[model samples]
Target: MTILDRLTGFANPAAALRRAVQLFDSGRPSEAFPLMAMAARAGIADAEYRVGRCYLEGSGVPPSRVEGTRWLGRAAKRGSADAQALLAALYVSGLATSEAVKGPASQRLFEQDTLGEPDFVAARELATKAAEAGSATGQAVLGYILTRGPGPMRDADAAHRWYERSAAAGCAEGRLGLALSLARQGGLAERDRIADEVRRAADAGLPTAIYLFAIFTEHGLGVAGDLAAAARLYQAAAEQGLPSAQFRLGLAMIEGSLGDLDPVAGEAWMRRAALAGNVEAAYLLGERNVKYRPPDYAEAATWYRRAAEAGHQAAARALGSLYLTGNGVARDEQEGTRWLRTAATSGNQAAQVDMANLALQGIGEADDTTNVAGWFEAAASSGDLIAAFNLGLCFVKGVGVPRDEGQAAQWLRRAAEGVAEAQYMYARILRDGRGVAADAQQARAWFAQAADGGILDARVALAEMLLNGRGGDRSPEAAVQLFERAAAAGHVGAMFALGALHSSGQGLPIDQVAAQKWFSAAAECGHGQAQLMLGRYLAKGLAGERDPLASRLWLERAAAHGIVEADEEFAEATSG
Candidate 1:
């Protein structure tokens, strides 16, 4: 039933292992696996290592780390340097063991036989032993540990030495590591050396090397820029299960940067990368689901949760927002707060602001002014203008901190450079000499900027300044234009100003009829001064036909509004 079933029996395990090596080298892994298993059962260390590799890679069997680790562990105990080095590599790559690996419970006879977490200390010891035994892969593993392992283990010079030794022994991973190290130095000679070494490693079929070479080609880093060639190399590495390469190829295809838009293939590749544990790919998938029309919010949440669990700050923020709003997920205030706090603690400015607002409004937490101000300060210090503006208001109103006019002015001034509300507030501070020297010119300038930004209150203030010549030269015409613009936007004070301007002929020819019309408009908007003036005008019939009843009604309305002058007008109209 198998290749080994019809073959003559090998004389010994050594002979069988030799034949298996030859068959495997010739690309007949299926035929080699039978012999390898036979040799492994006879306790041949190299055969055990090979069988383990076959299981891990699914070369002649379904991939199973639990089975692979069992074989590798046996060979390692038998002092097989290659097996020790391979186990070290697997541990470093987070593939040594996992609870996800499937097998019969009966198969897990020992603790180590079960797929469990990797142990870095054991990985380092195994790699050191194999390296001392002159295994090139072991040397490469040491280089990787020194270069990318935990903080205390990293040593750039030591990594370079290990990589150099491993490369001399002809390890593809060593060549790739050495090339990447040389690339960091950056020069023509280093560039050429890096390219040559990467090319050799890629030729040896190292997926990471191929991916790095593709990046070089794409960016013209150490080779001539060629997008087509880079795309081909990306595809090659992606097909070989390189998550980074898959991500790059997917992005390129999705954006049509490779001259062929294949959204179906691109999305499939993206999903593959995400499934392969590419955090950025997962986040990108979440963004795609959320940003498109008819958004699949549930799918977005799934991707976002994956990325967030892997420590993606933006994904955490987005997922938190979804939970808070019950979008695609049930509204869970506690869960939302937890995720948002994670994002905020990770230095996400927007999350900090969101958290602050939630605290202020008692949405997910009790209202805490101090906590709100602390969050605002954190975001404001990081250059969030909206937070800076809020912080300024907090200082001005003593909402969270003691009201300090000086601090308020300082914060408001920073926000005023971009925020219209802050500009208006800052201008008012300058005009009133609040915690600063009174500078009408500066106030007017800021008011003009705020007005241009569509602050109606700023427009009215600027118009008044122009009419009174408080900041610079008087310009009645400019004042009248500003007042009219504000009036059109429904500013009651602007209407009253227009009425007074027309009555006094300060900006235009005296037109009592026009004055009366503006007064009536302002009075309707509850301008008490406008009501009193309109009442007087009606009582004397200064602008139009006298109507005693109308004059009495206007005067009574003005008096009710607390305009003392309206009392005289009411008595005059009643007596007439």
Candidate 2:
């Protein structure tokens, strides 16, 4: 049976109070109200507090904030800490003590004409009484007001004393207040020692304490780190409707920053927090959706727009990219440039680089090297590799910068890490002695690295150097291997080099068939000399079986492409 059922049998104030609590917990505030009212009429202080709360919240009654204030005033006089704090909050926030009403405040009965006059003076007096009556929350709140000095004299010392007393009474908010008061200097306790106090208050069911306790657990502040435990606490606090907790928990779940990754749950939490105006959550949701497998650009734009409206610099840049690419919205270069400018003003490094690119390409604005260099320098200083490459080029050519090959090499060297183009450039500077002493050995090393890193031109250069022994020990065999690799990556020069190598028999055992095969491959790629050579090989059976028709056809095809030797050879063959 419900406590109310048994309490009705007892017909006593104590039983009535207990029954009211049970009903309130059961979400039956209407039922609890009558019992609380009955006890309140009998002069029970705690019951008076319950009556005031019910009226203030309009539990099973029309809302009359004026009447609620009156009841709250009575409860405060009866020494209810919550009642005192509520009244004080109303005054501190400058809420109309008696809110004007229109109709249907059914939960708390309020009358339009009976609106109570807003009274800061009464609120201040009630707060004093509540603090003197040992309300920890009231004392802490009074301490905050005293320290703030809103229309009064500031008293940091008195505020600290009140906060200390509130904390001693086991109030988590009081503990936080005291910590903040001392933070102006150091703190009341060492960082590790304060954990105990916070945990104790959290155990007593304080929201702020619970959040701090979760943080301590996550980071091992004063306890062994336990991220899963922290996540559980975050989940609990999020369910309790804490917005900041919801955003953090959402991120943790999304990134699996804590144990038990749940992307779906994480996204749901982010949506909840975002809807509640959490800018970070909004930005993260935008980032997540944009990077999702197969990407959902439209959805990402919606979230990005929300965060951008709140002045998130990165979101402005991201949205601009989407606009420019026509990924989520219509392609609009002007719009994109506008957003890039916005982010540039905030000194967003990537956005600055993008702006530089836009200016250089003449896409959104006129191509101007001065503007481009300025933007590139801004981004490059932030260690952007591509920006460094572009900036290096600018220094080398005096394009929007002074001609300083040494500076160019400096930036190029920094950008040479696994970047084929940069590697090639660095190697070229070293090999040619451009604004520096030529180091053929170093150049060869860089050329090899760049070739392997996938620069076809570097591969050809390295192969030629190897064949001629210009940079290091001559190795025709190694040169042949380099040519083969470069040709495989579609370099026409490498293909020609391979044909020459096979024909001369410098790298491997002489094989006429192999020579013909290399020549044929090069000829197919429109190498005129290789075409003539292949035709001669076929005509003389030097590389394969003699076939006059095939040879003639090859020479004729080569002559059509304006190869001078092939045309002469064709005329000679035709006359013979």
Candidate 3:
């Protein structure tokens, strides 16, 4: 006999398989897998089933669902009980429909037979065939169909009988379903017994069973709570690339519920889940990137688009914002409005607020005050802070609403409580006695708060008030400190104020040298007043030697920049 024939022990087929099974049981599925493949090729029924199972589970190499289904189909046709059960299970679970199943013949079957009508008759017939061959998984699948009735073949009694048989054969899913059904129907004692059987089946490697068991362990359902164990089970399923498990594991890592939170690892898991087409993961990744690390705007936009495509309202709004602001890509105002409108139609409050702003400003299209007011009202009704601020502006200015300073002040104060810009504007109202009694001390406090939040205008205004004693006590030294800070941050008014302070020696040592340098720097930065002052100092040699040419040049520039006194200075410097 040939060596292959000798190994099979048709001659030695049974003995060879026994040895392969021994190797497989000893964790040597690498060697066992090839031997099983050889036996399968030799038409050993049990070896065919084992080989297919190994391929399906990727026990010895990368998994091939298509190859696994084909081998299982061949073994099942030969009446192998294990193969029949596994094949039926795969079919019922939809895992058997691999890329290979998209061939013309399979497509025809799908379009003509499966898609055309409910075919419980055919499904039941196939299921019965596998069940009759002593396949527990097949019996369980048949039970599920009989209970649910894909067509007109509903029979709960038949379902119970099949489920009982499958449970007796150690099918974990069968036991779990039976237990859940019994629990729903008030058979509490039976439910408890079946739940234990389901646990045993889960321990033996059934993926669905493992997931259910994890849920039970985590929630302490009919068992003591064990979060750690539940986390481990979820991780195991995630490693197998199950999308739900991956999402849950990522959430646990992000929330630190499973231990120390790791944002990087959580982001990795979230990305994997998003790639697997989880809408929630896509939205979460987008939001996280937008809030924390916007350097990944392309990725953030992609995730936002995915969620938006799936009809997530918040994601659509976020995508609109990105498009409007050109966060990670070229700004497209038209596209931004489209997304904003989509989200607004979906009742997104933020989108309504944004739409109002865009409409009022004619940002992406023509101004539509009617639409703007409508969206603003909608946002305000939903308690949007920015919308309230905008509404106040509208009322105060009579842009789209009647002018009403009382209502405006009310809304402005509300927005100001949380927003720096609103705070500064509201402070102006109080300082100027507009619809409120003037309160210099309160105005200064508000200005200081806004300034501390990086509002450059607020800093300059506060510095001016301190320097001139306009709204509060005069403090030139304090004003100089504030002006210097604001000037360094590129505030033109603050630069002029600082130059004046150095030139006048008010609350500071007179330093003509420092004044000339400040004026020159400020003038180079396009501060008109500084340009005029620097030209005068250069022409008169107040700080150093005269440079009429430089002085005349600066004076000409200042005149062009709208400094009225610069024309006369320029003429005088040029004449001298």
Candidate 4:
């Protein structure tokens, strides 16, 4: 095309650029693009920036990052503030695209024409220069870099300041950033301001702002809750390729919050979000696959692995479990341990307990017992009751450290808040004054709790305390009931205690026959005291007709079990 036709008779490059901007403002990018390109070729910096944006977004031409970046570089080199800000943003985002040109030539082009490959340092440098030159877009980009770019560069206060400046300058992205900052501060006034800023930014067509506004509407944050309106806004942002928005819409559809339950469509949206690198979507897909009626274990493993590779701790733990059990992948202890360790090291409490158990079983590494205790402590610090109980045992028994009953009591007491076994152990500590002052009342209380949890030992201990009134008011009736219950469950101690209670008439009417029956039952189960008592009962005909042979036999058994008095009794029975 002739220059006159291309530029529309505007000999001045600035004049052509102004006409192109007017046309673009009127939504005639196709007509404006050629004129903008003409002005760019004539070395107009602002026109070069406009042409670059057009190429980048494919406003009036096919999208090409290579050409777009080239034009942006030209404009940036000529001191175009807008070009500098946009180029910085692209570099910071790694120019995300599967279609990005690659190879040595592409690398050279990126290095020479676009600063470098995803270099945050260079991005920050360009954004700083542009922001200092008073570009609203530059200020917004700089604010983003300060807010979420890198750990070392993050400065929330500084980011808020930059966002405020850019928002005052009328940048929609800046308004969105300012709203996010205000949301974090979290007050009635801040929420109201956030609502206003987010709405304005959404009106300006910012996808992230639309997504935020939708969340606010859905949850009634400084706005009336409206599911339908939130769903519509989610649809708009999702269609714009916002992964979080897509995930939200997917959840809404799956939960029937979008008028109908559409699992197929919901899952499709989730898959799209996952493919777009949404880690939570990937993790959720893995969970769904595993929870299906006929679980797709192989597919679950695949999805879990994807999220795990992206540093999702729950996904790593799930993938590790599958690998360890051979549920989806081949059983690979080394591989499973590696993944479990990955999550454990990242502060996943359950994963830490898993690793400790594996070590205890000698299933993974041949680590010393101390390593197991260390893992338990790590999880215990995060309020894991099982880990706390385990760590307490470790301290009490010196299995993995120096025996320290005081430390054991501390941990076990904390664990006792929820763990039945810990309650039982803590009760023992209280009863014996092992690590703290002996408190019979506390011991009885904890034993009762553990007994209710089905602990046989705790039932016996609590029954004894009740019968003796060691902790509170004596309740022989309650004691007898507890003993009977434990005896039914095959506890030898409870059976022997029941025999004593019957013999003493403590909880029921005195009955020699019942005593003899209970003593014989406990004796048969290897209770030495019960054996001796049973022998005496049989010899004296305490419950029925005497049987000398049975008495001698019982006495002999008790003697063999280390009951000193039974030896003399056995000799007497044999003589008789």
Candidate 5:
């Protein structure tokens, strides 16, 4: 028989519904809708259910939730299995209720008081009716709700039975629900099997199933880690314009573990997802642009604004940073502080640290040590290295906290593990025996490490220690070598040290001409000591002819750089 003849021959409403299901399954929901609607109007319960589904999901027409609900209610009243199941699921999920619905009101009657009550009994009744029918989707939905025991409904055994029945019907969602239940029961092997079955169903083109499968693969919950596969599946779903899938795909691409790193592409996908109302994608895109130097700051600011509108704490913090730094926007410290406070109160670590700094510096208002300390504490607790270093400084300086050497050392140690500044400070503490046992060798080692990591102060401290034999045996020649290396890298202290050594004939043969040249270079680099020494050489005509005017200029600049000796020498030179 032809397909149409077979469908016409079926007098059973259920059979007619099955024909419509076959049409829907064949990607002809448009054709199936009219037939389903006609059958529903003719008192065919299953047809009523299918028509409701088409309207509810907008598969073949403009969506009409009211019409869908009316048809589903009619089918449910007529004992249509699928319709009853869908209604049960909706009620259990609280999706059937209006968003403005409130809990039952409390009342007092003649001194007896009644508390507000949940409408769980109504939900349970719907779920029970659906579970009694041979609807696997209904069974799974009811099982999930009952197992959670939300409100007054609590029946683990019934949940387990329904889940098992649903699984037997080849329902992928049912299998996943059963797997979760098995996992809770410590049945790892069975849980894995069920999870695998769900994955297979997902591979067979179930939209929700594909999403769950991608999640499992991404997290390696039931399968080996397969981020590439997860990304592919997410991309597929995203191409279909699923907002959640778009966000997931964008995130994976941005992170670059699943495929070739493509920040621009990731940002593009995230932008699309954000426009689709994915708040997380908006937040992530905003953060990436703010921290990673995106090509367009205005676009990034727009995304940040969207996320902030959606109440994303990190995005608010990022927006604040842009405003504070005048990055892609005009500087506005007050607006920046306002946004930072919002994020800081929401426990955003970066915002907390920034808020602390702003408070300490009185950036937008009067300085508040108490508030600054609180923000620093919050940021430090969240593992912010800068905050930890600042906390250590506060302890050492008695800024906001009482001067406690032990606490200073503790916080410094934490920061020292990550920050060059903190490392230098901690190394100084070791060298000076401040709140800790003196360890010269340890101090030298840390200083060297910090210097190598580009801490200018650490480089100077290490060079000084070597020259003066503070932490190790004296090595004037080695100190000169260190100074030369640092000086070549534009370290002002190193340049001054090199110039002094040359002028005093301490490490190598004294060459007056060479000394003059080294001092000139150092002075040009703003080395105050070099400027003063060079000025004296010029005034005395030691390296060349006397040039009083040039000598005075060097002395004046040296004095401006806080050279006390230069001030005295400049006065003497001016008088002469």
Candidate 6:
């Protein structure tokens, strides 16, 4: 038989409890639970506390907070310091069941407050009793109550004295409490001392202390920034079953906040944390799955719905959009809009921007320019870049606001802080002196920014400016490269620019073949001038064998496009 199986058959409850403590300490709590319960049933105080802890945390048993509280109460009445400390915390937080906290009727706050309307008087009595009995946790908790003024008891000076005594007793919670209090009072040197105390508690393996230390390390607050160290601490805390730490570690991996991204590891951690009831982790899992290779929209919907039901506003918006587009579910625009409205009302900025877009496109039941502008304004105020851009356009076109160039420029400037397209728009206004002062140098800077951001129009515009010596220093070679980039991205104007540059040998050796190729590309895109030029090149055999039929065809096409010279050339080519 396994040790636990043998231990369960032992006649002596004391022996069973001893074996359970060994197993539990070795991280095999499942093997320890039955033994602990057996001893607890025989009235062993230590076993009772251990059993209560297991039930409270679902460590090795199905969690039952009520049962946990009952066992803890039994242990506390038997004078177990740990049990009294824990039971006092539950009462103070009002997390104990009504049956467990059923003191005299005078102590019952029957009304349901968010924290279940805990009986603070009872909590104080238990904490005071435990402290008087020399429980370090009890003393530290009593200090916390004083700080937070649980049930009209406020004594900061006494709280400080209690925390000092608890810390002297080697309690990590006491050290953590002192550290938090010191952080509020001290200058930089005091903050540094507080950090040392926090580190001490963390070294003692306090999960909350470790998690806070990780935050301090990651942000360089009162310590040198050490992302690697922060990640290690977070991992340690997560292993201790801290859901928030698990969520943090997952986000760090997914976003590469510490090092190279590891989406697989990130997703695994996120899934675990989500199952542990982390709404943010659930939302991130939905986002990741929605954009994963080949996508798992059904899985995305499931997670999003789960998080949304738990008050994750972004997940609500994502789920609504999925339903609207039928991405992973049936298309039900009415239902989708209802969810969207829910998210918007809950203050999700993206949802507000989405509502603005629907009104702008006249897609909603009450679509109107006024509603569109109002939603856009709300979203913009909440710092949404696209909403700011749309609001700028509305101001410029008087769509939902009076035409105000100054206001348009202001909003456009905010939008321009975000993306390539907005940068290009702002550059256009600067270049043309429209609704803003014309500053050729400033325009060039914005165009360069937009071009570097991979905007084809911005690339072509920047190239033209460089070639013409208008906005910046003239550099024909740079202009040629910019034109080539835009042309590769399928801009017909860029093709024409490349053809002209190659024909004229502005920054490169004359290459008739390259010139003809670029001219042909532009001509096929219905550029009349390019067709006429391509026709001339074909007729002249500039790059290869003459093709009379091809030349005549191009000339006729250009003439049809209103190129007068191409009409004359067409007449000449066909007249023979």
Task: Give the per-residue lDDT digits (tens) of candidate 3, residues 1-576.
Answer: 235634564446667777778778998877667667767778988887887788779988557676676677777778876676666566655666433333333433333212123345544665788788777878887888787766567787788888889888888767866765566567556645655765876787766666667777777766778889888887876777777777887888898886668878877888898888788999999888777743678778989999999999899988988898998868998898889889987888778778878766766444445566567767775777788788878777776677888777777887787788878888888788787788888888889888988889899889878988976789988888888899899887777777788788876788898888888888999888899999999888999769888889899999998777998878776776
Range of the 10 consecutive residues with the lowest summed lDDT in candidate 5: 100-109
Distance from true position, residue 340, model 1, in Å? Answer: 5.3
The pairs that clash in candidate 1 are none
lDDT values of the candidates?
0.86, 0.78, 0.77, 0.87, 0.76, 0.84
Candidates ranked, most accurate by lDDT first: 4, 1, 6, 2, 3, 5
Error of 3 at 466 (Å): 2.8
The local distance difference test score of model 6 is 0.84
Q: What is candidate 1's lDDT per residue for 1-576, written digit by digit as tens? A: 154542532557777888878878998888888888888988989898999899879987777677887788778879999999999888887776533223443565343533345556677888888988999999899888888888898888988888899999999989998997786656467887898899889999999999988988888977899999999999999999999999999999999886589988998999999999999999999999998799888999999999999999999999999999898899888899889988987888788788877765666555445666777898888788889998888888776689899999998999998999999999999999998899999999999999999999999999999999999999988999999999999999999888888899988789999999999999998888888888888878989767778878889999998777798778776786
Among all candidates shown, the one with the greatest lDDT: 4
TM-scores, all models, native as reference: 0.79, 0.60, 0.52, 0.70, 0.63, 0.55
| lDDT of model 1, residue 55 | 82
* Candidate 5 lDDT score at position 347: 76
Candidate 4 lDDT over 437-503, as tens digits, reads 9999999999999999999999999999999999899998899899999999999999999898889
Model with the higher lDDT, candidate 4 or 6: 4
lDDT of 2 at 470: 81
Best by TM-score: 1
Ranking by TM-score: 1, 4, 5, 2, 6, 3
List of clashing residue pairs for candidate 5: none
Worst 10-residue lDDT window, candidate 3: 108-117
Window of ten residues with lowest summed lDDT in model 2 = 96-105
Which lDDT tens digits does candidate 5 get at residues 1-576? Answer: 246634663555555566667778999887667667657777877777777788779987666555665677778888877777777666555545422122121221122222233335555666678778678887887887788756457677778888889888987667767766776777566756756866866765666567767887888877877888888888877887888888877777777967888877887888899999999899877667656644567767888889887889988998888888887788888888888888887877778788877766757554546666677877787788889998888888786678988888888889988888889999999999898998888898889888888887788888888888887898888777778888787887787777677777887677778778788888998878889988998989888768889999999999998899889989988897
The total of clashing pairs for model 5 equals 0
lDDT score of residue 214 within candidate 6: 96
Model 4 TM-score relative to the real fold: 0.70
